[model samples]
Target: MLTPQWLDALRARITLSAVVGRSVRLQKAGREFRACCPFHDEKSPSFYINDAKGFYHCFGCQAHGDAIRWLTDHQGLAFMDAVKELAAEAGMELPAPDPRAAKSAERRASLSDVTEAAQRWFEDNLSAPIGTNAREYLAKRGISDASARAFGFGFAPDQRQTLKAALPFDEALLAEAGMRIAPEDGGEPYDRFRGRLMLPIHDARGRVIAFGGRTLAKDAGGAKYLNSPDTPLFDKGRTLYNLHRAAPAARKAGRIVVVEGYMDVIALAQAGLAEAVAPMGTALTEHQLELLWRQADCPILCFDGDAAGQRAAMKAIERALPILKPGLSLGIVRLPAGLDPDDLVRERGAAALEALLSRPQPLAEALWEFERDAGPISTPEAKAGLKARLLDHVGTIGHPDIRALYRRELLERFSALAFPPRYARVFGREARRGEQARTSAPAVIDRLQQLAKGGARDGFGLAVLSGLARHPGEISRHEEALIHLARAEPALGPAIDALLALSETLDSPAPSPISGAIGLPALPDRNLYAFLIEGNSPDLVREDLAEAVSLLVEKPALKAAKAAATARFDRDPEGSMAEQGRLRAREMALDERIKRLGRKRAASPRDDSSRSPSPGAMTAQATD
Candidate 1:
């Protein structure tokens, strides 16, 4: 559990606008802002923002939430993790977690300790007698002694008990680190990567999370390359080897060079090309792509020029096309035949590899590779097939303008083949529709209302309501009318109470005089008085009282009325008369009208029975 102070600090750090702005193109609309929903493919913008309330709602998908909820759901972070991320973004330090959360923190710390211990043990073993063959193999591969130490290169002895006796660790702990192999005979555990040159894999934060090892001998009996098993600290799909070292170089170079193996990264770094990373014997995942995107505008994937490497590059391109923004690029660096990055660096030297990096193939050239090997487009059938394939590739590209330009280029390329005009028209229409959907305002408002009504029941509801309070301008008058209904009925009482509680938690001293900020609208004073007059359920009445108190605390006019009411209650403590009697009489008349409305509701054919009394009637009766 996060402490109140921590939660407050997180709130101050993150806002809905900042979260939405990163992925979507947001434009100001009145007091709020609007953008297309990134969670779903939308052409028209159905996502809305109320900066004042710090809330966002998507009309199309019915997604609604505050900043924290948005980050948790959109970015796939845990709730507290989202809080911490926002807190960090705001440059604020969070307080210690609650007592219950301390146990989780302790467990995490222990895992870190275990990982650090394993890394140290591996580093120490690099120069041990058992690592002689590994050292010889590295020397043969042109890896210097200094480079080996710099990368924590090491060896796992073939003996089963060597690792067990080397550290005060159990088999379970080794297994947890993905470094132990279980015996068939229930014997002692053995090393997972024997007779191999080890490469410690660290995460983005430079923690030794996992390992990758290369076979030093031809008859090592194990696979050529073995990676650490999936553990709490490592997910092969998500972790790129050498990202810790490559990130700064990638940022400095304004491009990342992705390779295929531990040696590829090590060899590149040794060759003075340090901005290279590779997956741990797996295809690139979106998580890894996001990490790369954060570091640079363009990433050059350097794969071997073999068929398998080409296929892998195509797959990576497909995975990235949808998420790649306008300025962001994905270029391919196809190495010479029968050569990986390491072999290329060793054979041709760093200057040759640097030349290859300089002449990267653009994203369009990679996409064109699909058409290069296809059948001739002179025939009608071939033309149709080519057009269809081209449209499919173009459609996968996320940006509308880019997709259209590619489509035009495809048509020009196939002009001699004589493809149907309908194909081009259809693709163009789809791109147009996507653009239209991203800019529409009414669609955003409709989605916001739908989200506000239905989304309030989920775990993210309070956050959504808080966002609404922060950004009321994104919400339309019609939507507000619907929200107003929540205050009049018992079914909506809990939701109202939840919103009020969330608001109370947000109240703090204004941070250094707000600049050009719109505040949330004042809650209706008459609504509160009406709820108190009517004999509603206790829960409903209590919520009404709370909401009234909150509003009065903020509004000067309402505060004075509240003081007068309190004075009347205090002055007529014994008499049970005075302004209280007048208020009760007004309450009785309002109750009669409510009963009449109830009878009318029972006779009406409408489905909704939660309508409130007419405002004019309530106001008239209050005056009487």
Candidate 2:
């Protein structure tokens, strides 16, 4: 894990607008940088990056966070990978690994050297006198020398001592690199790649880390394809084949095509589809999916059109659904029933495979297509099972918006298909339509009315939210403060989320005073909200909401602290007394902070107040 101090330094050292702008094509928009929202397909620009705040938010998708999150979410990098990448860009060395991890890290470097050396040796053999068989095989497959070199294709000679004579490393180190297989009894280790065609597998940085070998000779072995054993440097489950090369192409092409094997990726590349990548002779792994995502939010999975390929696609889908987010997803393409990428490209041409990729089904549709027709739906029990399975898959999604959308869409489809409506004149259409209208209308209205009361049984912490909804513009400015408040006051979670969603949708250019048109999740205390925003100037609302958010954040925080201190009183009186003293001081200081903001409101522009919490600066209540 990256240290907080290092994270802070990284954030501070880089200008977010510049970093995001390089990829997003941002143009200066007022105080922030703006881009046409990349997370969602939109015409007008709604994405903004606030370098001062060290965060970017997509008003379209509600994607908000700092640099680390951008890398993890938008770029599809793992947390540590993102950190290391950002650190490198900032010219900062990562903090030292734990002592226990240091040796593994050091050993991995030695293994990488072995893989690199072996890669060269294999490449040399592909062109050497002993490589005639390999050369002939490539020629027969229509692979040019340039193409083979581009993919780092190589060959392992039939003789076992070829590596023994060529590699400088000893048997022990070679075994660690997955280059040699040691005998169970006390025998010398033998070459692992004898009589095979070799393809070097690279990490995201394009460093050779592993090898995938296809047997060349007759009666050659245990499996058709074998990958390097999972060693310290190579874990097939965590690495994608050709990612180091395909990532840039994926970014430019706006999608990655994930095939089933290294040769498929090579064939696609040969056919001018440079964006294709593959798994290392196994099912696609979660990490590989993430790697694809780093290049494009929605990657295309091109599976061979066979029962095995369908199973592989399903496995990848099941592994990926849990991490599905609002703006990131997958697309699927099943090749013609019995052919793979290489076969398709070879038989018809690049255009034929390109045509298949051009028409990709959404993951939801793919999931529905697979599960819906798996068994008969004529029986209600089977239909119910389909619905249950769909719900289960949707439930795994982590993002609230995507989860909700998937559920709604899937359920609606199930309801229509499992229990289709009757003719309009008969009764079903009119009756069901009326029922749905009544069911939905009262639901949202009654909930809002109850929330506005702050008195009914269904009260939803409405007071803080009504004021927030009336001044959604303030939500972004006070997000951190609100996040802290949300933690201390769980009851306000729904309201906070609603306000955030509404605020993100609000337009820039300094919003007008709250109107009835401001969509809110729940109604506020009507009289208070009306008095606060009706005919109020944008500046006045900013001042008022500034104070409101301050109070909302501080009051709840202080109250929680007091309650906590009181609880600890029975156990640790002295500590509780000290805590109580600190809370009281913070409470008073919070009052002072509010007073200072009030004074600043009268004297300065709205920008001064709207600038999000400055570096190392916090409201007194937050300090507590």
Highest TM-score against the true fold, candidate: 2
CA lDDT of every candidate: 0.62, 0.72
RMSD of each: 23.5, 14.3
lDDT of 2 by residue, 333-410 (tens): 988899999999999999998998899999988988888877888887888799899988987888755765576557
Q: What is the TM-score of each candidate against the true structure?
A: 0.52, 0.59
Local accuracy of candidate 1 as per-residue lDDT tens digits, 137-213: 88988999889888888777666666667767667877777778887899867877676677888876567888887
Output the worst ten-in-a-row residue range by lDDT, candidate 1.
Answer: 507-516
TM-score of 1: 0.52
**Candidate 2, which ten residues in sequence have the lowest lDDT sum?**
615-624
Please report how far candidate 1 places residue 446 from its true position, in Å. Answer: 45
